[model samples]
Target chain A: MEKVDCIIVGGGLAGLSAAYGLASEGLEVMVVERGDYSGAKNVTGGRLYLSPIRDIYPELWESAPFERPVTRELVTLMGDGASTTIELASDRFATAPHQSYTVLRARLDQWLADQVMEKGGMVITKNRVDEILMEGDKVIGIRAGGDDIGADVTIIAEGVLGLLSSKVGLREQPTARDHALGYKEILELPSSVIQDRWHLNEGEGAAHLFMGEVTKGMMGGGFLYTNKDSISLGIVVGMEAMRERTEKVESHTLLDAFKELPHIRPLVEGGTLVEYSAHAIPEGGIAKVPKLFGDGYLMVGDAAGLALNALLTVRGMDFAIASGFYAARAVADAKNRGDCSAAGLAQYEQSLRSSFVLKDLETAKEIPHIMENPRLFTHYPQAVSGLLEKLYTIGPHPSQKLSSTVIGGVRKDFMNARTLKELLAMRKI
Target chain B: MDIVVSVKTNLDLQMIRIKNREPVLEAIPYKTGDLDKNAVEAALQLRDAVGESKVIVLTVAESNRKVRETIKEVLAMGADEAVLIVDPALESTDQAGVARTLAAALQKIGSYDLVLFGEGSSDDYSGQVGPRVAELLGVPQIGYARQITAGGAGVLVERSMDEYIETLEAPLPAVLTVVSEINEPRIPSLMNIMKAGKKPTEEWSLADLGLDPAAVASSCETLSNLAEEQDRKHIMLEGGAAEQAAGLVNALLKEGIVGR
Candidate 1:
């Protein structure tokens, strides 16, 4: 039997990160993946928060196949035939370190996996781990294809469907309610066209978030992210909400509603669909984190339920990278001591709790409940869209000020007393 | 020439979540383990190289139901007959134990031209089994084979190593672990999926193999507790794009992916 310092499961962002970290420490590590390639089965909104990746792969931007750095952000409120947007643009993020960037997961994951292999780590792809090989209560190795591959420590970076995580007792049974499903389509558009339409520079990108009628009163949001030559557009809906309303609606209907939104139509007009992908995300927030470490093992990234504080933002990729870093640290420390056990690996949990991942998830736990209010997904966006439409439209009669129009629209959608209560509740939540 | 392809299923990590001090997982409805993609692909390639009529797909798992379904999919993708070892007691067996079980089954089946498997599975990711099973069966095994070719009763395979690749020539009935760097796996066609349903999936129980549970090695190592969490912080960039870009670049430099 061959023994390694550590074995990491899953070859996506988290597992690759752990492998990279462990290999950098001169420890022998092996990473196993079930996919044809690291990102073959992965699907995401396509935007990566730049901070965590920058911290782990500092000069990666120089040669990495990044789509583009985000230079503009748009928040839109949608109505039947009208929409209002809050646009923010700053020329600040164009240099070395970026605020955020976009990438196709398939390509980025493959590159990151290469980095792990380049650092003297072993990468075994298209392998599925069958079971955990144990010595008493301790995990000593993993079983695949009827053979045991021993390791001092095992880090599970398997993405959302962490089957082994639960089997190993790091996680329990996850219900659909604690998760969310997202379906996306990538639209091919020329660079110049994207630059002209989204008002971006040669290598810049834009991100747009849609709320209200797009989800059709469901508890979710829609997003559009510009890539090098394409746009990633998708909608994420709460699994529980989807289940609750399943009999009455279908995803295609919701998709059609989203596509029919006036502002969305023009943005995607004439674009050709190049790819379609769907994936499930763990949105259970901080309260949902499973056991992060146990005897001889640690969990990182989506396997540990690392998501951003708010569903509106891009978070998982950065969190996955960061957690993978910590898992590697814990394993390295354990390897130095020649020990891989529950107690020896406890530092992985401690380090993770101390990182920005747990804190963000904990903070964002309230956002979901706040978003549960019907008005947030229904009345509020409609009210804002109507007010914007009134502002932009010409009138022949004596003018009504923007303030009055906004007040009138707000009143039409919500009573003053109720609106005040909702605002207060939103603040408290 | 019949072929045996080993496949194993793993937890779908995409639906996995850490909740209430536990890692929660949901059972996958139906999908072969990712590595099996390579095995099926390799078999189809060999079949295409030789003849589809000669290739066979096989798997050994505690649960033959899923294995049978998976084999059918493999057949649809291009394989022939399939063999499944359906022993309930082997469900939680370790790698060595599984290897022994599969070897015993292979011995009973006898006369396989080639044996193929994925480098490792995604969930547990143990890369030892193919070689171990080969050891048990006393056959030459090739690890991390990115490309394989059958010629003159021997197989030519490109074995991918940490930093280099080696082309190895092995005799017939060799065990090969496929790497993702190999050819892309072909998706099963609609007609193939339908035809896979008709492929013969031979089921064998421990009783069929005349094996005793006590005879096999058993190591019950259980993973029961894991505690780690992620903390996310959104530091809204204070300055405009240029400032944020500089800060981002500095952060990247700290991470060490780029040169100063």
Candidate 2:
């Protein structure tokens, strides 16, 4: 039987990070990935907030494959035919250990896995782990293709689906209500065109988010992040809300509708579509965080529901990296004490709680519930656009007072005491 | 019995992007040709049928990191070992040059009862390498074998021809090319992928195979390889649903795309 000190299932950021940490510390580690390469199956919004990862590998920013630094942020609220946008660009976002950078996971994860291998870790791709090998309620190894490979401890970072995690009873099967389905397209354009379209300097990019009519009143929104020479555009909708939708709208139909919007069409005009991908995001927040440790096992990343959907910004990769970092530290401590039991692995939860991961999740735990409010998707955006139209439209006719016109439009559509109350409640989170 | 399977690393055509009416081939992902996977599967199946056999995978390409990665994929697919012939001089080699390099590699391997290849590669569907290699090696060649079976001291192949299928018998030490319909390629399990890393893979240059670069130089030169831009009529039919459907039918009839 082939044996290793640790076995990591899934080769995304979380699994690769743990493997790199353990291997760098002179531990035997192997990562088994199901994709042709590390990030072939990974999809994200997607941007990596570099602070958490920089804390783990300080020199990574110099050599890591990053698309562009996001120096501009834009958020748009779309009504039936109009949009109100807020754009922010600052030099403060471009400094060292910068805010965030857009990443193509297919490139970033592969480079990370290569880093793990360069550190003397083993990474096997294009192979799926069938089951977690267990001996009397403790994970001992992994079984794939009628062969058993032993390990002292196994870490499951199998993304949102968490197939192996659930099979090993470390997590519950995620339901549609707890997840959001996302579809993305990578559109190819010249770098100069992208720069001109988004008003970006040499190596700077923009991250844009859209809500309201983009989702057609569904509980989700759209995102567009500029890569080096391509634009990643997609829509993410709540699965429960999608299931409740009266119209049988396909996800691609939503994306196409979004592309046809006057505000979005020009940004992507003349760009050739290069790739389309779809994935599910864990949206249940901390409420859905699964059991973090078991006998001879631990869970991290989306497998443990570490994604945060704060409406304006959705973050998973950063939390994934942070959790992987802390999980490795806990596992290393357990190894030093010569104990690989559930009690020994309890330090992982403690570390996560003391770190920003669980703290941030706990603070914003109500954001997901607030995002489920239908008025945020339907009424408020239309009212805002209507108020803007009333204020801006001028003709030969007599004009009413601006305040009265705005109040009349808001009262007619969505702005009322009840909605104001809900908005205030959402802000408290 | 022993078998030599010829594989080619070609740009994934599905992932190719066009820019300025030209294929943007730089940094495009490379993989074993889609049909070449069927050839490898056929070789592995034959190895199993022969009771005891070794499958040797061979590829001739410009030596680079991508070629090495592509070789590991086939090795993981169950090839016992592999021979990679990479040289900068072979960068622009044509089908004839590829056939010569493969023939020389087969000669260097000393002995093999059979040779296998895909009917055509994805990048250049020239369908010439297998027959050319057979001619160079002076062996009987079978093309487009849809089904193969082992027999006493020989093999029976069901050849797929344009008009009709023909059954042909070839003795040991012959070459055969297979179509995608032959068999489904197996995805290597995790254990197989792990073991593939430990498998013996040897790198050989033209000099290692006792072949002079000048002798096997490519004769055919490519003049132009450009992306074909498709032109479409941007006609809009403005009316109600039924009227728009009628308008589309009329337009199709005017273009002779549909019969009345």
Candidate 3:
């Protein structure tokens, strides 16, 4: 049997990050993937945030198989028939050391996996690791395909829904409490139409977030992002929240509701859906993260419950990449010291904590509960939309001032004191 | 010269829908398991290569009777015989135990030049039964086969691996588990369906095989419940076509994909 310094169990962003980092240091690594290839099973919200990548892969945008760069961001507060949207554009994002770029996980991860192989790491696709091989409570290797592959250390980068972390007694069996399921569709549109619609130059893009009746009053939000000549559109809902609501809902039913929303309809009017998919995310925030270090093993990315700052918008890929980078660094350090024990691997957890991954996760832990309040997700968007409708409409009747329209909308949904509290509470969280 | 291909009716995953939080697999239509697809394809291919008189279809799920109707459909594809291995006690057996009962029937059939199976069943995905059956029958086995070609006193097969492929030859009467890409299965013609009715079908009961139900019953895995993951919700983007395009681009950027 060929022995390796490290074995990674997944081929997502985190796994690839670790692989790239370890291989760059000249360590023998193997990535066991369950997909047809690196990205066959990966689904993302369609962005690659740049802050994390600037230090590791500064010039990756030109070399990477990215779709486009986004220079605009839109937050839409929508109701049944009207919406108030805030669009923010930054010319500063247009230059290199770019702000953010859109990437297809399939293309990006495949490229990253190739780079790892290019650096002499072995990537084995179509193999599912069934169990972690242990020696007296220490993870020594992995068992897959009725064959055992021995390694000095193992990094469990398995995706969020994988049960292997719990199987080896490292993490508790996941519950609906800490997770949400997201369903996405990739629609194909002409590149010219995309640029014309989004008002972008050849390579620029924009992203939008929607609230209120689009979800039909559920506790989740919708998103749409532009690609080269296609769009990534989807909805993500809290699992526990959905369970509490007494509604018979299916993803397709919710999809139809989103499509028929007056504020959402024309955006995707003539596009053709090319791919439809469903995936789950760890939404339990910082509190639900499992044991990050154990006997000769470690978990990172979604498996470790390191998702993103939830209320700021769904962000996981960047966190996944950053976590993977740190995990690989730890493995490299442990190798340098010639110790692959749990104590040696604990460096990974420490470094991750000291890094932005943990600091941000810890701070944003309370955001989910704050966002869980239905009034914030519903009445806030409804109130904004109602106010906008009154301000924009030109009617034959006596016109009301914009201030009166805002006050009237707030009074319809909340009393003056309650409106102030809601705004303040939202700002504080 | 008769061939027996074992098949089971399983839940059609494509049509299965969850209503009231219960997976209605039974309510959904049934389809032949992946193994049976390869078995039928193998039988049809052999029938064309050797002669039609020697090909047969064998299944262990005859008690359902609906299963027999399915077997007829297989015969319609080209099998010269249709046999059903039916026994009330055989229901709900695990992979290892199912292999045991199958080994018993294969032994009673006496001898054959070859026996083929798909790499594994779809539901269990155990990928164990073929090798386990070969062990029981005292025959050499080759698995993960992407291509098979007849050879002297044995067969030559190409085993597909993750990156590399290997080809090996095993003696005649050996067992082989084939892969999906081996061949495109054929559909039964109208004439073949009419002819299948006249074909021979050997129906076997548990008593005929001299099997004790008590021995096999103990090996079955217990089933308590079946559940499915809940579906997600929809969050549509806003601001007409231009806004929608801008929204997508912005999401990608927020995801940290675009600029720096």
Candidate 4:
């Protein structure tokens, strides 16, 4: 078997980030990806919070093929008959150093791979890593197709499934209850039209989320993000919630139904459907995160379960990139110390623990349990929208005083003991 | 023995999209053309059979854009070396200019037992470069070669034709254009991909080829390359399921698609 300094099991953002980091420091690294290209098989609801990883690769982002800087945030609490959208625009978010940007993984990953190549790294696509090769459980390297290529350290960033790691017993098998399936469509609209529809200032973008009936209260939500000349509209549903439902629904049909909503219809009108993709997202939070480092291997990205979905601020890509950056730094340090053992590579996990990658996941530790309550996805959106609807309704009959109307709706919805219990639990979040 | 394969890089047509009856070329990745890969495979197999042979990939930059990565893809397929003929004058060059530049590079290499090429490029199926370069190099050429065999001083090739297969023998250092039937191109192993970038590659400009840039400049212009507008036949059959099935069969028979 031929050996290199490091082998990355996937050519996603995480693996490429690690490769870029290592190659810039003149290390021999190769990334194996199963997709025809770097991101040919990945999908995202797809916005990157750049602030978390702004300093990881400061040189790469300015010229990166980011679709648009996200400046506006909208969250729509949707009900069966009504919906309410709250839009927030901040000067800081719209400033030169924008906090986040909407992304299409195919474009972003390919461009990042190019940067990796520029720094002298090999991103071998169309090759699936079949096994994480083990020499007495030291994680020597990986076996792909017919080749067993050894490395001082192996980095597993094979997205959410973690098939290779799971098969080797390095990680636990993913469960339906711990994951969510996200389906997305890249719908193209004219650039001017996109700006006009999203109320953006030319290149600025918007990130919107819809809850409640969008997912039939299935502990999920619908998201719409504005791209340069397109919009990514998608729906996410908890796999367990989906499986337990009496009315079995195909994921695509959910997106279709969401799009048919009166509130959503006008937003996607006249848009050309360009791409459709569905992927499983790791929503297990920190509790389901597997072992980060062992022997000669380090797990990053979704393979390590380093994804956080804190409702309105769903995230994964930033954590993936950040973990990769830290992995590279740790690997470089390990090599410098003349040891590739578990003890030497311990810095990988330690760095992630200290960085925003793990810290944010820790802060959102109770999200998975909190999200399972179902009412967050169903009753709350309806309650909020229904109350607002009452407050704003006017007719031939004389309406009640505004204070009375507000108190009545509040008493009817929020005054219950269960509601109080739920509100009391909110402090954990 | 030493073999040189001329690979023409083209945009991955599968990734291209037709928008408003026009091909959107933005962000479409360039790759070693489809049949061009078959040419590389043939060259690799021949190099292995001939023993102690070198396979060098030769390419003329179709445009001034970066082709190093595209050429490296050929090297990953076991080409020992790469020679890229890149010049500002060749940016929009037509078939003749590319053939001339390829011949010039072959002359510079000046050491090979055989030269191979795809019958035609994936993007532009002109099928003229191999024969044209052979003419410019004053070498015997064979086209549409499906099977090639190495001999003492030359080679025997089985060429696929419209109605029948014809066998032809060409002397050493001849040019052969192969079809997709030749062989399947190997997906380079991880090691090969890792080493591809380190392979020896040379970049030659028009000056290096001893040709004046103005003389080798593109002699052709692409007026308009728009996608062909296809009109779907709006055929509707007003019938029940059984009648619709019978109607579909009858329509297919009328079109000679289901009849014996």
Local accuracy by lDDT, each model: 0.78, 0.86, 0.76, 0.90
lDDT of 4 by residue, B6-85 (tens): 98888888898999988988888777788889999998998898889999999887443467667778898889999988
Model 4 regions more than 4 Å off = B62-66, B232-260
TM-score against truth, every candidate: 0.62, 0.80, 0.63, 0.95
Provide the global lDDT of candidate 4 against the true structure: 0.90
Residue A350 local lDDT, model 1: 83
| lDDT, candidate 1, A1-429, per-residue tens | 656678888888899989998988988777877776688788888888876557666655577778999989888877656777888887676665687889898778878876876676766666777887767667777877555777778888878867876776668767786787888898888888999999988989998888877787677889899998889999988778777875577876777667666656888887878678899888777778888888888889888888763745757988998898888888888888877778888888888777777766766677657766657877888887777788787878987887887788767766688888888876754
TM-score, cand. 3: 0.63
Worst 10 residues of 1 chain A by lDDT: A52-61
Q: Candidates ranked by lDDT, best first? A: 4, 2, 1, 3
- Candidate 3: where is the Cα deviation over 4 Å? A59-61, A394-396, A411-421, B1-260
Give per-residue lDDT, candidate 1, residue A269. Answer: 84
Best by DockQ: 4
Between prediction 3 and prediction 4, which has the larger lDDT?
4
- Write model 1 residue lDDT over B47-130, tens digit each, in one string: 777774366665667675446446656777777777787777776677887788778878888878788888987777888788
Which 10-residue window of candidate 1 chain B scores lowest in summed lDDT?
Answer: B188-197
Instruction: Kindly report which residue pairs in candidate 4 clash with one another.
Output: none
**Residue-level lDDT tens digits of model 2 in A39-149:** 989998868888656767775668999999999999988888877888988879866658799999988998898788777677887678899877888888898767788
